[model samples]
Structure formats: structure tokens, C-alpha cells
Target: MRNTLLVLLFMAVNTISYSQNQFTGIVKDAENGEPVFSANVYFPTLEKGDITGEDGRFEIGNLPAGNYKLVISSIGYTSYTTEINIPAEEFEILLTPSAIEMEEVIVSTPFHQLQSENVMKVERESISELNKNGAVTLSDGITQIAGVESVTTGTGIGKPVIRGLSSNRVLVYTQGIRLENQQYGEEHGLGISSMGIGSVEVIKGPASLLYGSDAIGGVLYLNPELYASSGETNGELRTDYFTNTRGYQSSLMAKTSGEKLKFLARGSIAAHSDYKTGNYERVTNTRFSEKDLKAGIGFQDQKYKADLRYNFNRSEIGIPEEIGIQSTRKLPLLPNQVIDNHVLSLDNKFYFKNSSLDFRVGYQFNDRKEFEEHHEHEEDHEEGEEHEEEHETHEEDEDHEHEHEEHEGPALEMHLETLNYNLKYNLPKIGNFEIITGVQGMYQTNDNFGEEILIPNAETFDFGIYTTAHYHISNWDFQGGLRFDHRDLQTEQTLSEGQLIEGIDRSFNSVNGAFGVKYKFGEKFTGRLNLASGFRAPNLSELTSYGTHHGANRFEIGNPDLDNEQNFQVDLALEYRNQHFEVFANAFRNSISNYIFINPTGEEIDGEAVFEYDQQNAMLYGGEAGIHIHPHPLDWLHLESSFQTVTGELENGGYLPLIPANSLTNTFRVELENIGRNLVSSYSFIRLRSVFDQNNPGSFETETPGYSLLSAGIGTGVKLDEFMLDLRLSGNNLLNESYISHLSRLKPDGIQNIGRNIMLSATISL
Candidate 1:
């Protein structure tokens, strides 16, 4: 009888075990047949799942033995689901396009437009690219998103341009604060830098509602890393040493978590003397060096959480000092150009049962100093000999006269101080209806004491308030926002005549807004229509400036009576995603009223050509589309490719200046696992880039030619360990291409980029 009881017990245990079963599978792209790495695989019944590893492999243990449904998803791709009967062994699965079911969901939206219904596009194109500058900081990264172009400086600075709008027409924000820096002047374009950003979000079109003025081009939001609710912290330390570039950089970041408090701290140090050209020649001051540091701390609870952050950045960079003789120009890339920044912010999130509040207040101060030695050209020329007689040799003779030693005409020190505050709230009063309102105020001052032009001192005050609403009703999503701005500027200057031009004041007030509606069909498809109106009051530098533009090597003259430039935009977007693939397309048209532009009057007034700032009606239009095919057939690697183009026309039908031509970027990455003791390898399989030259050269501009660049990266044998290493090998203008960028100086010809170079990087965790 005991033996019979034991048999019955064993049977009962087996029956219970049989109730649960395990499921395993591999995922791949349908078109290219590549394995999907890091693809999300989830089971509704299980409520948890694992991501695909290299070789497109995934295994889920301890699943109940029964019928189940599975979901797969990835960014920039479609989400997919399938039903299966699970036994025990591994199974291979495929996902279909989400477009079929999306057509019925045209009434749904993830976020609402702030104004009237119009089409718009939002993109995160820099997530996996190797070149960080082109992705997150300033405008360089957004240039690859269709209808976008970037105003590129040196290796370190860049800004985005949408359609044909640039400068004051663009609005760039970090997290949500309208970043403060002198973007209006190329000189200050490199001032506000983004060293460590997680992602860059781009919204193309007018964004006057939630964001005030200067949003005529588009909006670029820099997203930072956040702590999780579990109170678990994670971080990384990276160090890179490059040869041809002759630089060493080290970065450290840490995060800590607890039930109620979490914090993050990051610091980086980098210094490099100079860079070498393709011929292996040192490129002097072209090699600027510096150090950066950032820190943040926060606390979270079931209802609310708050964080505090402080950032300190100090650097001494190389600012090319160029001189022109006759028709040839030579830039001495060896001098040190110094600039530094410090910022402190307090941010908080308040949560209630059905609503939430997010707020941030911060203070920023930027101090900049520029010094240059005027190199005597040692040469002079007369106008057309016929005109020479009219011009006379007296003017030419004085030009060649011996010059006295001077400190860059006179040392000019500029100071900018800003105070900012903002608050946004979400309410559950109307179920899916939400509203956000906030205000921002700033005070900026510029002091100049130079012996040369002795530009007077200036001060600027800016204030604005904005509101936005989001409503979701059934299959449709609606969004809209409106903003009002008030600006006051004061300037004082002394002319060559020794007369004091004192206390010039200007003020402007305007309103801008955007509205859009989103529709969702079933689950796989989405479509949006958006229309927006925005404006930008003339900036301080635009209205009252007497300085030299170093990069373009031009003597800029600011227009004091300039009126506010206005923007109107319309955008259309379509999204189709599922499983291993996602395809997106965006198109837009923008029109500007009183669009400000630098027009060459040809007549040289005083010592420089009357290249005065002027305004005219303008228009811009363009579109871009892309597709993501993960794990085409391969299971251990990933590939992403994109291309963008733009076109702009002045009301007079003239093409805009300094507009970037067509460009393309392609990246390949590979990740490994389990070489030995959880060791893994991360590698950049390949990177390819191509840029078209700006053949639409201006009167003072020289034509440029298109070129291509190729690069590759390889890492150490193990990545899973606390320490990982990477080596990068690259060649810019690989063909030894001698092509000048659109922003090159206007002389006989233009300068070229570094010929070729190599670099290596490493990261560690504790």
C-alpha cells in the first residue's frame, strides 16, 4: 500500500508541472533577413520578457504549457504580435506590417498639436550614430532629418537649420529650458554646449505655443537620463585617446538609488594640443582643448520627487585667426580662444492620484573673452585702373603704411547673466484632457571695451508666457499651444567721428501658436496634421553690432531698425511600424514674413562693403523618408540608414546663403555576449557619410564640391566586464578631397577638413 501511495504522489506532481511550459524563439527582419538585436519580446500572460541578443536569439524559461500571445517591438519600427501553441522546444517566428490595421486608427494620436490642425514630423535620428556632435548638441545632428540642414562650425560646433530658416529663426532647448547662448552670432554658436545627452528630439514646423519665439526653424530638445522608480542606479566611465587628433579625454558618471532618494553625477576631462592634416601636418589652433563637469541629485516618493543639478564647464579652445593679402587668405590655427560656462538648476515633479506637476527653475551665467592680433596684409590694390585714378593712390598708400603693435584692436570682454523659471501641470479633471502653462524671463548684458571699434555696451531683457492643451477622445488626439513674448533691448556705441551713440532702445511684442490632430487606426499605423505660426524679434546682435565674423571672415553690420521676423509652417507625417520594421515619411512648407538676411549692397561704405542686414518675404519646402530593417537575415548585427534634403527661396527668388546641400548617414553596430564569464564585445561595424557641396555659391563665395567619408571601430575581446575598450579608425575627405564647406571664408579659395585620422576609446563600470 505504501508503494501505491508513492506512485500516486509522483503522478500528482507531474500533472502540476505539466501546467507550465517554456517558449523560445529568434526574430529577424522580413526584407533583409538580418537578426533583430535588442528587439523587445514580450508575453502578455507572463508580464515580463527578454531582449534578443546577437544572432537574434531569445529564450524564455518557465512559461505555462498552453496557448499564448507574443509581442515584438523596436524604435523606429513597427510593433508585431502573434499567437502560438507552446510545447517545450524553441520556435522561430515572423511579424507582419502594422499598416493594415492602422488605416482604421486615423482618429488616434500620441500627442496633440498646439494650434490648428496641420501635419508635423517628430524624429530621433541620432540614437545610434558615432559622431555625437551631429546628433545631440546644437543643430548638427538634426540636419540629417529630412528638410533639415546644420550650420557647421569647426569639429566642435554646429547648429540646425530647417527649410531655409536659420539663426534667430531657430529655437533650441535642453530638457525644456530655452537654452541661452549667442546662437545669433556664429562666434557664440559654440558657447552653449551639450556634452552628455541621452537623446535629441526634433520637431519640424512652427512651435510658437509651448515654445515662444525663435522657433521658426524648428525645436530641438536635449533629453537627459532619468532615475527609475525602483531606486536602482547605473552609470559608466569612458576614456578615449586619439592619435592624429592628438587628444585624450576621460568621462565618469555614477547613479545611486534607494526607496526614496536617487542621484546622478558625471564629470569629464579632455585636452588636446592640435590636429594633423592628411599629410600628417599639425593644424595649429585648429586643435582646441578643455574640461567639462556635471552633477545632479533627486528624491522620489509615491507622490512626488525633486532633483537638483549643477554643471561647470571650462575650456580653452583654438580660434582660427586668419589674414587676407591681395586675394589669398591664410588662417593661423594656433591661437587659444577661451570660453567657460556654469549652470545650476532646481527641478521637481509633483504627482497626485489623477494629475501631475513638473517644474524647473535655473540660473545661468556665461563669460566669454576673445583676443586676436591683426596681421598686416603687407599688400594693397587699386580699383580698376580707370577707377584707380578716381580712387587715387592716397587711399592705397595709407593702407600699406607701417602699422603699430596692438592687442587685437582692443580686448573685448562679454558677460551674459540669465534668470529663468517655468511650471507645467497636468490634471485628471476631464479624464483625457490635459493643460500646461508656464512663463520665462531673462536678462542679458554685453560690455565691450575695445581700443579698435570700441563698440559700446548693450543690455537685453526678454519675457514670455505660453500654454498648451492635449485632449484624447476615442480614436482622435488633439493638441494646441499659444505663447506671448515681450522683449526690450538697449545699446550704446561710439562712432569714428567721436560722437557717442547712446541709449538706443527697442521693444517688441508678439503671439505664436500651433495646433494638430492625430488619428490612430487599430494598432500599427498613425497619421498627423499640424499647422503653426511663430515669430522672432530681432536679437541684440542683429539690431546693434559692430564686430567681425571669424568663420566667414566677414565684417558684420547689425541693423538697428530691423522688424520682427515671422514664420508660418505646415507639416504632414505618416508612420507605419510592426515587429522588425518601421517606415516614416515627413514633408513640410514654411513661409517667413520680413525674413532677415545678409544682403550684399556691393558698394563699400566706410572701410567695409555695405553688407547690411535686411528683411524680405521668403519661402521653404522639402520632405524626407526612411526605413529601418533590423536583422535583415543576420542575427548578431544591426544597420540603420537615412538621407535628407532641403530647398529655400527668397521672396525675390534668391537662394538662401550658407544652406547645407544633400547629405546621407549610415551606421552599423554589433554586440556580443558570453565569450567567457559574461564577457561581451561591442563594435562599430562601419560608418559611411556623404555630403553635397553648396554649388549655389554667392558673389563673395566660392563653389564647393561633394565628398564622402568612411570610418570603422573595433573593441576589445570582452564588454560585459567592468572595463571595455574601443578603437576607432577614420579618414575625413578620404579621397584627400580638397573641398571647402559652405561656411568657408570668402577668399581666393577655402580651407579643407582633416585628411585622415585614428582614435581609440574605453569604458568601465564599478
Candidate 2:
């Protein structure tokens, strides 16, 4: 691992080179051919950008020979994007007046196109809209998206499930880097705060050609807040409160930019008490708290760009068991967790005459500790029997050592470190085609420092190379790509009871590809069809775990010879849009070979049931449909409805576990424009969601009952001179309905989901 880090660092330093490539352009207003000054010009793919001078002229040099996307934007103009071939000497660009809301741009995929222009369809949501739904956590907010669900252990721990797959099947990307925080664990959460994020994008099908392994289900890409415009400074303060858990959250952010330099900083704190059920009964030991901080800086010139960012997060969460006494205590009892995470990233881009080169490196560290009560046996708890013989015997008995301090430290502690690297080159365009080639890799290590051992100490190395292309012809776009990946894993040897336990050393490789096309039937209709193949290497836990899992109260045995799980999927999407109405539908089918899962052995080990990891062929299919309409006479009144369904089954027979039940949701929203004397904008909405009963459950899984939930919210924004004040009030399950979610891990414990949550938040921007 050390050698790998050194090599990556060396490459980052040596990748820079001086070239004669140069690009120059002039920006002007579309309505009037007047020069637009100080406009920001950038290349999302290359990460090299510049600001137009006072004369509306910009120049960048040392560019590599390649095809790139150039984005131009200003404070009062709509963002403009177009494909640029580097060798061109000078060019002219125009910006139009900013519309009420411009089409969102997606950065997760390589295309970097607007939502309406991309060959593949992706779902997007802004942070403000996510908060309007009154969710307590980031994962909770994401569940509002159709076809997306979360697997929850408690109120504070959640793992995203896409198209009925999760736990090492779904991938998460943040800060332009992959997140590696022991995602294979069921109790592990996303470990990210939504404060510093600007928006989120989701791809509902296989994306392995873009993001290596574990993208079989999908990818969740988080886009950080953009820096303030050139020569401008801005800041915001916000606070929130939730009644269900008595939680409070606060955050502050500041950003500034200059001609060639930019910087940003943010901090947030949150705390919550135990959550209450529909019957107003407290579920004890469900409390959690978090502290997060982030900072970033960047420097840009005509030909070179460099940016660095770091984030630190600390969280303390409690694990819930049987219902205990209802209390408002802030601290939890025994059986809790302390997690700390740190991420650092650097992005560099170099521009040549007709192409560009990009290099990104990231380092992440995660420390997780689980604490539980340690009870001593009667013989070991002896005290006050101070006879000379007894004292001598106790002193000589090695087993009695540290008997009084058994409960002082955590029962299980694991530290994980990961380093990731990527190098990509944008090849010069060929006729009407754009091409990209890249190499991605990672090196990781995990070590245990406590009594409990879930998985053995291990080291993993991964590498992949891919090539993708986009071809444009009239009103149709074509995209396809292929990738090859290899992974090697090794675990340290261990001994139990003076007997050697076999060590594992293995390697796996695979080939994957994707092809997709987008066609515009007319001005108001578009359609997309994509077919992709993805794979997931057996995780460390599935291959090396051999011990008691305290969180699940079971003994687990791993299969050292487990092979990679490969999947092939087909996705179809259709959409129609006009001024006042829009509708969309997405459908997909996936087949997997060697799907890894735990199987009950019908045996007991030291009073705990034994389960072993195994493999089987599986299939999944699902679709989501939705429509939004605004009546002509009452444009302020909006109506929307959506339905989502998915099912997974083994090739032989039974269904899969943790599959979300078929569900439908509807919303009625009203836009309050000029309703108050000082209000600039305001809105209110109500939603009715229904979940159908899950009659088809996997093996060892029971059926779930159907239920309906009601929720509503109101928000307004007031402007005072140059400052703005925003306030929102929202409620979930207003009727306090008692229901159990089919995807909740707590279902087996007979615990109902949280109910009747009232949230209030305020924000002030300057």
C-alpha cells in the first residue's frame, strides 16, 4: 500500500507538461451582439476553466489535443454548453437570458450533458427540494425518488437500495471519488452529510463501464456546491429542528472567488434523541449525533487547473434492541458505535492544442468502534476476599487479568484506509464523434484492533481500463463503451486455539460493456434504450468472515472460493414534455450469475444460529412511471403521481430478501406567488403515499401488511434588500399511522417504523 501511494504521488507530480496547444474565444449576449464581461468559461470534463476579461475575451494554452465540452455562464445569463475541438484558433459564443429554471447538468456520467441532451436518462434533485420533504437524513430524503429505497437498521443508519439491490451492489460517488467505508456491512450508513451538497444524481441501471465493480444496481453521484462567481463572496446560515426525535441541526458555509483563485469552507452539527413510534412509545438506544467540517481551494489559468479539498466527519450512534424506558437523555446506554471518517482529494487538468489530460487522486480513512457491556462471571467478579492464599492465587492466575476493567473499551474496532487514482485522456474528435479513454485503480487495507473480528485483516488491489465514445447525427445520439477490470485480495493468516486457520489469496477478472442511444421523435418527445453488463467482486466479508456478528446476533462463516457475481441488464425510458405537463416511464430487467447470499445451516454455534455465504443465480425486474400536470387556468396548482415496483427471485424458486413492495404516491402542490406583503415566493404541498402488501417474500422472510401515509409542508421566502430569509414547516405521517416498511431491517424485531414527525427549518443568505 505504501509503495502504491508513493507511485501515485509521483505520477501526479510528473504528469504536468508544457505544450503549444491554445484555445481562445469571445462571449457575447444573444439578444444584442455586445460583449459579456467576466463570464465564467469552463470545461467540465477537463476541469480547466477561465474567466473572460473586461473585453469579453478569454484565452487558455498548453491544451492537449482532444474533444471537450465548454461551459459558459454568468450571473444573469443561461449557462451555455457546446462541444469544442481544441486545435481551433478562435471562436464566438452567445448566452441567452436566464430562464426561471434552466435544465440541470449532470456530472456523474462522462457525457456531462444537460438532462435533456444526454443519451442516458438520470434522475436529479436539488438540496432545497430534498429538505422540503422534511427528511431527517440524506438517505431518508433520497427515498422520495421513484425506484429508490433504503435499508434501515434504525433511524440513524441507512443503506441505499436501487432496483432491489444493495450492500456491495450499489455504488456511491462523492467529491469526484468513490467512497469506501465498509459498505458491505448492513449496519453501516452512507456516512455523508447533506449540508455541503448542491444536488444528487441517480443512474438506475448498470454503470460498470464507467465506474468499475459494484455498479450492478446503480450509482449515486453527489455534486458539491459550486464556488461563488468570479470576484464575488457569499455565505449562508441554516438551522433545522425535528419533533419526532427531538433533533436539531445547524450549518454554515462561506465561499469566495477571485481572478485566478477560489476557496470554500463549511461546518455542520446535528444531534437527535430516540425516535417515537406511532403509539408514542420510545424506541430506546436509537439516538445519534454528528459533527462535520469541509474546506477546499483551487487555482486556475488558461492551460492548467488544480483543486484540493478535504472533509472530516465524526458520528456517535446507538444500536436499538428491545423497547426500553422512555427518556430524553442525550447519551446512549451500552452497545453503541463511534465512527470517524476523513477524505482528501486533488484534481488536476492540463490542456493541449487538441486534447486534454485529467488526473485525480483521493485518500480516505475510516475508523469504526462498537462498544457493548461486558459482564463478568461470578467467580471473576470476586472482591473483598483478601486472604493471603487467595491473593497469591489471583496474582498467579493469568485469566483473572484485567477482570475489573473489562467494560472500559470498545468490544470491536476496525480501521480502514483507501487510496484511489484515475488518469484519463480526451482524444481529439473524429468527424462527429467524441472519444474518452481512462485508467482507474485503488489500493486498500483493513486492520482490526479489538476483541471482535468480523473479517480478517486484508489488502486489496484493483485496476481497470475503459474506452467510451459518443456519436452525434442529426436528432439522434449514440454511445457505447467497453472496460476490463482485475482485482487481487490477500488476508493475513490467523490461528485459533493454537490451530492454524487457512489464509485466503485470490484474484478475479472480468470484461464488461455498454451501448445506448437517444432519439428525438419531435420537439416534445424523446426516447432512450440501453443495455449494459456489470459485476461485483466478492467482498471481504463474503470471503473471509468467520466469527460472531454482534449486530445481527448470529455466527457467520465465509466461502473462500466464492467467485465474482456478474450481471447483464436492459433499460428502457420514454418521456413527453410540454409547457404545462410532462410524463416519464422507466423499465429494466437484470439477470445475475453467482449471486452471493447467506444461507441458514439449521445448526447452532455457541448458542447462536450459524449462517454461511453461498451463491445462486437470480433475476430482477422493475419499472417506474410518473406524470406532472399543471392546469392552464390554475397554473399555481400542480398535481403529480408516480408508481414504483420491483421483484427479485432465484432462478430455481424463492424470492429475494429486502425487496421493496410495490407502491404508489401522489402529490398536490400550490405555488403561493405574491400572497403576502413581503413574501417574494412561497408554496405548500400535500402527499398521499400507499404501500401494497408484500405477499411474495424471499426464503425465511415473512409477508408484510399494506398501509397509507399522509404528509404535508409549507414554505416561503422573503427578500429584504440584498438579503433573503427562508422558512419551512413540514410533517410526515400526520395521522400517526402505525406501519412496518418491508425494507426495514428492524422488522424482524417487531418494531414499527417511526411516525408523526414535524420539522421546522430556517435559512438566511447574504
Best by TM-score: 2
Local accuracy of candidate 1 as per-residue lDDT tens digits, 1-766: 8368446744543454333345678888776678877777765433335578888878765454444446676532355665455564686755433321111100111222211122345555433242422122334445545566656544445566766566667777664466675567654454443446555666677766656667777776665554432334577777666554556667778888665566777787766544444443333344455567777776654334577877777656555432221111111222334567777778666543434556667777776655554564334442221222343344344323312222334244555666666666554435566666767666667665444342356677878887777776767887788888988888775562344444578898998878887887766678887888988888766666555554445556777889988878888877766545667777778888998888666765445555667888887777776766555444346566777666677887667776666777776756444446544544445667788776765445556787777755555445545555443343333344444466532223344555555555555655
Off by over 4 Å in 1: 1-120, 125-149, 192-194, 227-235, 277-283, 321-336, 374-410, 449-456, 493-499, 547-552, 605-608, 631-639, 666-677, 715-736, 744-749
Estimated TM-score per prediction?
Answer: 0.75, 0.88
Instruction: Score candidate 1 by TM-score against the native.
Output: 0.75
Residues 1-766 of candidate 2: C-alpha lDDT, one tens digit per residue:
8479557755764575544667898999999989998787887766656689878998765455566778887744667888787667699999875422346668887868777788888988887898998989999999998998999977889989998999899999888899999999888998888889889899998899999999988998888888776677888999999999999999999999886699999999999987888977767678889999988998876566788988898988888875654554546555678899998999877665556677889999999888776763224332332322343344334223332333576788889999999888877668888899999989999998877777778999999999999999988999999999999999988653233557889999999999999999997899999999999999988987777787877788888899999999999999987756789999999999999999889998888888999999999998999999876667677899999999999998899988999999999998755557578788899999999999998786799999999999999999878778999999999999999899887888888899899999999987
Best by lDDT: 2
Query: How many steric clashes between backbone atoms does each model show?
Result: 60, 12
Cα displacement (Å) at residue 260, model 1: 2.7
